[model samples]
Target: QKEVEQDPGPLSVPEGAIVSLNCTYSNSAFQYFMWYRQYSRKGPELLMYTYSSGNKEDGRFTAQVDKSSKYISLFIRDSQPSDSATYLCATLPGGTSYGKLTFGQGTILTVHP
Candidate 1:
């Protein structure tokens, strides 16, 4: 299996829906979990970062990690059309590979009017 897997969601939601995006990883050696948001052709912007397992919340975005299950998630509280973007989950391997990231294919999210 690939080290990481995620649905490439073109998930559409109404103006204030709660949106959930997720990914799964196979390697136990991954130490850092991160979420990134990208728009059009621009590079991704870091949205959340967590070491090991736990949850981190910032404004409309919340990220959760479960090391035991090798799963990670992102939750969007107040979805808006302006919030529409591709969400990518990434991880860095432990030890020497800690700075290098492996990314999921990314989920394309669209918040409709």
Candidate 2:
């Protein structure tokens, strides 16, 4: 199995819709989970970071990690057209390998105004 997998979704939602993106991984050695949002032609900016399994919330965004099932998720509340972007899930090995990340195929999201 690939270390990480995600549906490359071109998910479209109306403005103010809630959006959810998810990824699954097969590696138990992964200890860090991250969510990144990338605009066209721009490098992805880290949106969320979590150690092990838990949840983290930022304004309009919430990230969840479940180490047992190797699943991670990002939820966007009150979506906007400006929120349109590709969402990528990434993982890194714990300890010394934490700096190097392995990424899932990103999901494209479009929030229409």
In model 1, state the lDDT of residue 36.
Answer: 92
Task: Write down the lDDT of every candidate, Cα atoms only.
Answer: 0.93, 0.94
TM-score of each: 0.95, 0.96
- Give the alpha carbon lDDT tens digit for every residue of 15-50 in model 2: 999999999999898989999999999999999999
Off by over 4 Å in 1: none
Top candidate (TM-score): 2
Error of 2 at 31 (Å): 0.8
